[model samples]
Target: MHAIALTDGLPILDARSLVDVDLPQPQPGPHDVLVEVRAASVNPVDVKQRAASPTLRSPRVLGFDGAGVVRAVGDGVTLFAPGDEVWWAGQLDRQGSDADLQLVDERIIGAKPLSLGFAQAAALPLTTITAWESLFDKLALTDVSHGALLVMGATGGVGSILLQLVRELLPGVRTVATASSDDKREWVRSLGAAATANHHGDLVGDVLSAEPEGVDWIFSAHSAGRAADFARVLKPFGAVVSIDSARELDLDALKPKSLSWHWEYMFTRPVQRTPDMVKQHELLDAVAGLVDSGRVTSTVQTVLHGWDAATFREAHWLVETGRTVGKVVVER
Candidate 1:
């Protein structure tokens, strides 16, 4: 099997950072499925791992979001068969999907959306999982009918899906998103945001001017520094959910408003090997249904072919640049 592997921790711009290597095909565990790699998407996590994480004894394969056909299943795997098409954001600790074949736990895999191609399906798993878990699971804003919900960084991968999910699930709720450019603002509106503001300008003042009473929920997908400003714009007793990691937060600033803070990490379940790991499969199934019904669209913006070292390096560089509108996919 051919794989892209990183033997050293280096910048993505270096062509030799990721190199093509031939390795024996991986064997599945009791609850695993061996998938023939069809397509995969690059995420910020991949860039971070390549640039920061320490080099390992064995070359590390780096990719998380993927869609492909199952070529084999372990003895205890019953969710899929050899010919079933599936999609998933594989676990962080495991060898990732940037190879000819990769093994993933069947509990985290879902059937691919019938309406989308392999590349399209590959774009949804990581972003969808993050948005779903952040809004519904962590924030507990499932019944947001009479108030407003604010989403920061609304044009990125998770933010794009988050806007659509909020529209579908909370129809009556008002949505305010933050984007820098008119094009991005229009894109968020197309996804059903009621209002869009500039993240570079005064977010608190802009949102306050739109809704004098402040919003009910805030989902911050950008820097944690934005949380303090978000706290200022949130109503008393409201909640704020953040996915970015910051050095420090002034928890005291949230005291006057009685605000609650929640951190959302979509990889928590899979990384910790939690008891409810199968819930990811369930969520992906719902997401697939939504996509198949035309209620949700694939966030894939660019596609790169061939799962080689050069291609992986290019994909990492694109993600590192932080200008991609949506997901970037690579197909084998």
Candidate 2:
């Protein structure tokens, strides 16, 4: 199997930083399934991982979200068969989805949404998992009868799905979306945001102008370093869920308002080998059901040809630029 890998360069941003390698097809563990990867999608984590840890041992394949047909199943795998079309986000500690063949635990896999193609399905798992877990599991926000929800980076992959998920799951809640460009603001508006704000300037004023009472929930999908930025716009006793990395956050700033903030990492379940690891699979299936029922739509905005390092570099570049409206995918 041919795979794209990070072989050299300290902060790799191009094909020179990655290479093509031929490796034997990976065999599955007792509870794993071997997938013939048809298409794969890029995420912000891929960009972050490739540029970190300067020294590469031999080579490291990079990808997490993939959609493909099951080519083989381990003896202990019962949920998926050899011919089932599935979509999943692979474990972070193992080889990734940037290969012709990849092995993933059956417990974390789900049947692909029937309404979407392979490329479209590939774009959903990772971001959908993050968004679903952030809003529902981590924050425990299934109902929006209380107040509005604000998403930071509203045009990104996770935010795009987050906006729609909130609309479908909580029809009565108002939504405030923030984007950097006019096109992005319009995109989120189409996704059913009650209002859109420019992340670049006067975001709080814009949000307040849209919702005078203040937002009840804030989901920061992008840079989450600043606290004062949204403090005035958020209601007292509000809650926040952030998925992005933050180097510095003043937790004390929320004391006066008694605001509660939570951080969500989508890989935590599989990474920690938790007892509820299978929840990811179930949640993914639920998301698929939502997609199939016409309550959700694919967020893939750019689809490139051939799953190779060159094509992946383009996707990585787009993600790093922080300007892409939605997910980018490539087919093998």
Candidate 3:
């Protein structure tokens, strides 16, 4: 099997940061499926993992979002079989989807959207799961009749899909999203956001101007240095959910409003071996149905046409630029 791997947590600028390597084929464990990867997408988690550790005794593969076909399955796997097309964000604790073949638990894998190609489907799983969990799971937003929600970093991967889900699931809710420019604002609107705020300008004021009473919920893609802004724009008793790590957030700011804070890590179910881990598969299938119905669209902004080390490295560079509109996918 061929894979792009890292032996050290070097900067992307270093030539040795990511390298092409040949590895033995991986075999499936109980409940696992061996997938032949056709396409994968780069996320911030991949970048963070590459730069988090100084050195590794063994090569570490680092792609999470992928679309592929199952070549084999563990004896216990009942959800899928050899020759089944699948998509998923593989567990963080396991070898990721960067390899030509990866062993992923069938519980986390979903049928790929039939309406989409491999690259388009590859760009969705991680972001879709994160966004879906943030809204329906963490926020318990399945029944709200009418309210305003704000999404920070709305043009990014997770935020892009999140807006679409809001439109599809909670039609009564109005969404206010944060975008830095005119183009990004329009882009977010196309995905179903009712309003846009400039993250660079007065974010609190911008959101407040859209909804006079403040938003009912805030979904933040990047929460660093924006806790105060989030606190100011959320109504009393409103909740805020974030996917990024925030070490120095002032919990006190949210105290006055009785605001609740939550962290939505999509890997929680697979990493913790939660009893409901199969929810990922269910949500993914639901999203695929929406895609097939033409109610949603793939968020792939840029596609790298290859399945090699150089292409993967270039995908990382695009994601690291912090200005990518949606996702950067690499496909064969």
Q: Which lDDT tens digits does candidate 1 get at residues 249-268?
A: 76777888999989888889
Compare candidates 1 and 3 on lDDT and give the better one.
Answer: 3
Off by over 4 Å in 1: none
lDDT against the true structure, per candidate, is 0.88, 0.87, 0.92
Task: Mark the 10 consecutive residues where model 2 has the least summed lDDT.
Answer: 8-17
Question: Could you give candidate 2's per-residue lDDT for residues 36-148 as a string of tens digits?
Answer: 99999999899888877476778888899999999999999889999999999998999999999999999899999999999999998998989998888866875646578
- Checking candidate 2 for backbone clashes, the offending pairs are none
Q: How does candidate 3 score on lDDT?
A: 0.92
The candidate, 1 or 2, that scores higher on lDDT is: 1
> Quick one: best lDDT, which candidate?
3
Q: Is candidate 1 or candidate 3 better by TM-score?
A: 3
RMSD in order of candidates: 1.2, 1.3, 0.9
Worst 10-residue lDDT window for candidate 1 reads 138-147
* TM-score versus the correct structure, for each prediction: 0.97, 0.97, 0.98
